[model samples]
Structures are given as structure tokens and as C-alpha cells.
Target: MRLRSLLFAPGDRPERFEKALASGADAVILDLEDSVAPLNKPKARENVHEFVLHHAGETALLIRINPLTSPEFEDDLAALSGLHPFAIVLPKAEGAASVLKLAGSLASAIPILPIATETPSAIFEIGSYRDVSTSLCGLTWGAEDLPAAMGATTARRTDGRYTPPYELARSLTLFAAHAAAVPAIDTVYPDFRDLNGLRAYVGRARRDGFSGQMAIHPSQVEVINHAFTPDASEIAWAEKVAAAFAARPDAGVIQLDGRMLDLPHLKLAIRILDVAGR
Candidate 1:
């Protein structure tokens, strides 16, 4: 549940599942969607089912199912019904209605981590998930498919940045997740070989209020985890804020270490402690 870094492993490559588990990622996603070839869909689903049944209790596992409209959806659901992985990643999710429909169809009560703002329509409907927060654990965005869906040249800029439109989508998804009281997870960095780029990306995400990030490769996990975790300075500040607030519970504001602390500052201190505990 404390997802600092969630790595993806292709469902067809069942042999890599254990390797991914041992890679020190907080979670591992068995991808049945984009990572699997079209011809291997059936095999991928079967392998995921077998993997789930065999390793359900060993690690935090999530299955990234194909889009809802895909022909493989029903079988995907059927294969996962009894296995009960930690959660399901609903790709290309457009709104709360889709999440509700899927929740209603499932025999088990698994929490969903929906890529809520992937397509253009999805960006418009991101707010709708607030009404169905009970069925969700988190919300994330995807940059890869949305631009292609809209016939855009690219989601990332020439300088390896997200264009303004995609940036808006990412920020909106972050706000929507917080509004729903669920964790906001940033999308993958795509450039698996660029460790420096990945570190900078993860740092930006943590600073921008994302609780965690999705990782495309195992090598990216440590950097993401380090970025998201509270550093020593942060822990010291949080402790000071907590002490100040606790010592002056009835005061509206208190000055601490040459700075004024208020309710907002106290709340952030508590959050830091909570995350640190995790």
C-alpha cells in the first residue's frame, strides 16, 4: 500500500515475476496490457492467473488489465476473480462510471488504481471519480497512449518535458486523486536508461504532490523510492512542527525557529510522520 515505486513485469514473462519481486520495488505490476503482444493475450492472461495463485501472499501484486472495451476484458476479470491480487490497474479509464461498472462485475472486492486521465475524454471526466472514491485506492495518468489517441506528435517535449497540455492533464489527475482522498501516482518516466532523468522526474513528482511514481524498469525503483521518502531535513522540520503544535494546542499560531507555524503547517507535519511510518 505504501507505493514509493511500482515496477512493471510483462505477464507473458512469468519467469521474471520472482525477479521483479526480489528487485526491492514496493509493488510489482503484472502487465497484461501494453507489455504483452496481441497474439499472446490468452497466454499472458493464463500466466498471470497462475502467477497470482502461486504468489498472492508473497508480494504486493497488481494486474494491469487491458482497456475496458478490449475483447480480453471479460477473460481478464474471470482469471483474476479468485486469485485476489492486491489491486487491479484499470488502463484508459475515462470516468467513475467505468470504475463502477467494473466494480459491480467483479466477484471479489479488490481496490482499483485507475489511470483516470489518459485520453482527452478521460481528462474531462477526472473529477467524476470523487463520487466513487470508495472503490479506488489511487489514480494515475498515462502520457504514452493519450497523445497517440489525439494524433498529437508527442506527449514529451524536445527537451524531454511534458508539453503544456499533458502537464495540465497530469496536474488535474493529481488534484483529482487528492480530492478523492486517494493517493496520486505519477506516470512512468519512459526513458529507462536515463537514471539522472528519472531521478529528476521523480523529484519533480514528489515536489508536485504525487505520493509515488510508476516505474518501467527495476533499475528505476531505488531512485524513485529515495526521492519520495522524507529526507533528514524534512524529518527534523516535521518533528519541530509537531513539537511546536503539541506545546501550543490552543494557540492559533506559534513562532518556531524564527518562523510562524499554523494549522496548515501542523497538518503537513502529521502527514510527514504518517508517511515516514509507512
Candidate 2:
């Protein structure tokens, strides 16, 4: 699946659901966490339930349910049990045990995409996700909740880079996803009005091995998609590397341009070509 952009829409506002689906995002996540007020969770859960029932198989849709620690989590799961969305986005997930428990409760093969970083302890347990890799749709992180949990004033520095602690969280999320063999989706850019900044953010994310980015607005979708997609230059480079490897099938090493290329570089070239469907 092409998950270059996963857009989020508030679950309580069903009016925006169809519009989000039409926004050209690879996935539309109906979010019931943080965005919806405490009093509004029940209504939001129902909205998500009905929306999934009508549109489950039509698109790559997922539900961002309340955290397992939240009171509404069970209700959220029960509401969607009849016919689950393509995947479930479990927020504030600390480790593999919570994911496995959810899978056991659902008793289905539907994938789970965990927001792998949200609490202080979550930082230590990032690597444990490898145990539940089979049911994982992707592994992503969030910065907003972590600062609140840690009593930090902000998660970002003055220059917009994440603060040191959150930076560590981001790195662990990236590593965990790769270790689990799933897409590493970066957190939302949060500034929908700044297209140039958004572009730079997604560019950095793709370069760092993150395969997708979460979008808060439709305006961010195109930029996210373009940034993650291997461009013509990248495609050409990947093709050249692949062809070089093909010609020297029996050789264990090769040289490309002025650099030494070997098994790892060849593997990366193949992955790039595969992502481009080339």
C-alpha cells in the first residue's frame, strides 16, 4: 500500500469524513483521541462506527481510537467490532503487549497502527514492537502528548526541530518501524498554512527513512506524497544501481560513480525501485 500521506479528521464531525476521503490522501484516519472532547467521545465513536460500516472497503480508512488507558477505549473498540476499519490506530501504546491484547480481543486479522511514542516509558519499550510485527500496519509517533506527559513546556525547539527528548522519541519510532518491517510514519507537521515548511519537513522525513507522514489538512497531502515518492532523479539513480547489480550478478562487490557499492546499497536500490513500482 502507498502510505505517503495519512490525513486525520475529527471523528465527531462526520460532515468532514467524505471530504477527507476525497482529499487525495493515501489513508483517512477518523480520530477520536485528543481532538475530541471528553463529553464528545461517545458521539464520535458512533460516527466512526457508522462511517466504517458504510465505507469500510471503499478506501484505506483507519480509526484513531482513544488510548488503551482512556475510559472510552473499550467503547471505542466495541463500536467498531461488527466490521472493523482497514486498521486501528492505537494511541499511547507503550509496547507490544497492548497491541497483542487488542488483537486478541478483536480476534481478527485486521492490522494495528500504533502511535509508538506518547509517554515517558514508551521510549524504553520501542524495540518490543518487533514481537507484534505481523499485525502491525505501521509504526508512528506523536510529539504533542509526550511533552504533556513529561511536563515540558514544548516538544519543539525555537528553530522548530524537536527538543532533545522528543528527538530521541522520533529516532526510536523510526528504528522500531524498520526493525518490525513496517512503514515509519512521521508525526504531523502541525502548521498547515506553511507549505514551504511542510515541504522541508516531509523532505527531511523521507531522507531519514520515514516512508510516510501524517497530515492534519488536505493542503498538506500533495506535498507529503511528492516528498515521499521517488522523483525522476532518484528513480534514475535507483535504476542505474539495479542494472549495475544485475550485470554483475555473480560479483559480491561493485563500484558506482566514485563510491563502493555492495549488498546493502543494492538492497536499498531494489527497495527504492519497488516503492516506485518500477
Candidate 3:
């Protein structure tokens, strides 16, 4: 369940399926929307079905199906019936209602991961995800589609940082995920070749409480995994904080390293340890 990196592969490309599984990502998302052309969707669906049959239980394999509003949505669901995937990645999701709708369409109940922000209305519905969060594995956002929907030239500034509006979308998605008690996955860094830039991007995402990031390319997987994994120094600090609180079991506050350690600090320490798999 360590979703530090979810790598995407086109659904029609059965040849690359094994390669994506070998890329060291925590999960692989076989995409049926946006990546594959309309005419190729049937073949892609068959490819996904066959791939899942062969490797369903081996790793965390998810399918990014067409949006609920798309004409192809029902066919996507029909094609995936009777098969189990780690989760379904719902793109262009408006809110909890959308999650429930997809859940109802599935032959069996499976966890969902929604790209919560892709359209203008979707931004306003971010907070509604808490309603169906228990059924979600994570919540992610996208920068590309939203800008296109709004007719904006770009989502990012010349510096590669998101513009104000898109930054709002990103922040809302992060908060919504936490509010719903699910992992907040950062969107992909489209320029996959820019390792240095991707590193900096992952740092900011991790610093802001995002638990994972999407990887569009195999090379980005390593960087995402490394950035999200709790390091030795962090683990040590969490252990020390936890030990201090454990010794003062009844105390709401304790002094440690000339600082006042309180309940919130202990909570954060516990979370850090959990993330470190202690």
C-alpha cells in the first residue's frame, strides 16, 4: 500500500506493460483515456483485460478509465467486469457523487483514486470528496486538462511553478485528500527528462504533506520514490519524540531538547514513524 510512485503506461501498449511493472513504482496505471486514440480503445480494452488476467495479484495495477461523462465510459466498465484491479483511477471527477457513480457501475467494489481537479467545476467540488473518502485509495490532481478546459495558455509560469489559479487547484486537492483521510498524490512532472527540476518539485510536494507523486516516465519513478520515503534522520527524530511521549504517558505536554513537545508533536511523530514503516 506504499503508493510513493504510480507510473502510467498507455493501455494499448501491451508490450510496455511488463516494463512498467519492472520500473520500481509502487503501482502501475494502465491508461485508457487521453493516451489511446478513440479507434484504438477497443484493442486497448482487450489488452488491459489480458494483462490483468495474467498479472492481477502480482502488484498494484490500476486502470485509468474514461471519464464518467465520456460516451466510452460504459464500454470501459463492461470491458473490465469480473476482473480485479488494485483500484480504478477516475479522471475528471467532480466530487463524491462521481465516485459513487463509478462504484455502482463496477461489478465488484474496488477502491477508487480520483483526479479531483481537471475541469473548472471540479475545482469547486474538491471539498466534497470527504463524503466518499472511505472508498478511495487516494486523491490526485492534474494541471494539463484544467488549463485546456479554461483555454489558458499554460498552467505554469515561465519559472515552471504553477500559476496562481492552478496553485489554488493543487492546494485544494491536497487539503481535500487530508480532510478525507486519504493519500494526496501530486500530479506528474510533464518534463520527464528534467531530473533536477523534478527533484525540486517532489521536495515541495513532500514538504506540503503530499504522500506520493504520479510518474509519467520510468526514470521519474526512482526520484519520486526516494523523495517520498522517510529518511534515517526523520525516522530517528520521530523515534525520539515517540519515546519521550511514551515515557510520559499521562502528560499532555513534555519537555524535550529545550522545546515544549505537545500532543500535536506526538501525533506528527507517530505519523512520521508510520510513514517510515516502523
Q: How does each model score on TM-score?
A: 0.98, 0.97, 0.98
Q: How well does candidate 2 match the true structure, expressed as C-alpha RMSD?
A: 1.1
Stretches of model 1 off by over 4 angstroms after superposition:
none
Report the C-alpha lDDT of model 1 over 1-278, residue by residue, as the tens digit. Answer: 58888899999999899989998898899999999998998999999998999888987899999889999889888778678888899999989988998888789889999997667888889999999999998899999888998899998889888999899999999999999999999999998999999988998999889999999888998999999899888988999888887887798799988887789988888888889982
lDDT by residue for model 2 (1-278), tens: 88999999998899999999999999999999888998898899889888999898876999998888778878887887787688999998988988988888784678999998998888888999999999899999999999998899999988789988899999999999999999999999999999999988899999899999999999999999999988899889999999998999997799889988998988888889999999
Ranking by lDDT: 3, 2, 1
Note the clash tally of each candidate: 0, 0, 0
Alpha carbon lDDT of residue 154, candidate 2? 97
User: Which lDDT value does model 1 have at 62?
Assistant: 92
Candidates' C-alpha lDDT? 0.90, 0.91, 0.95
Cα miss at 136, model 3 (Å)?
0.7
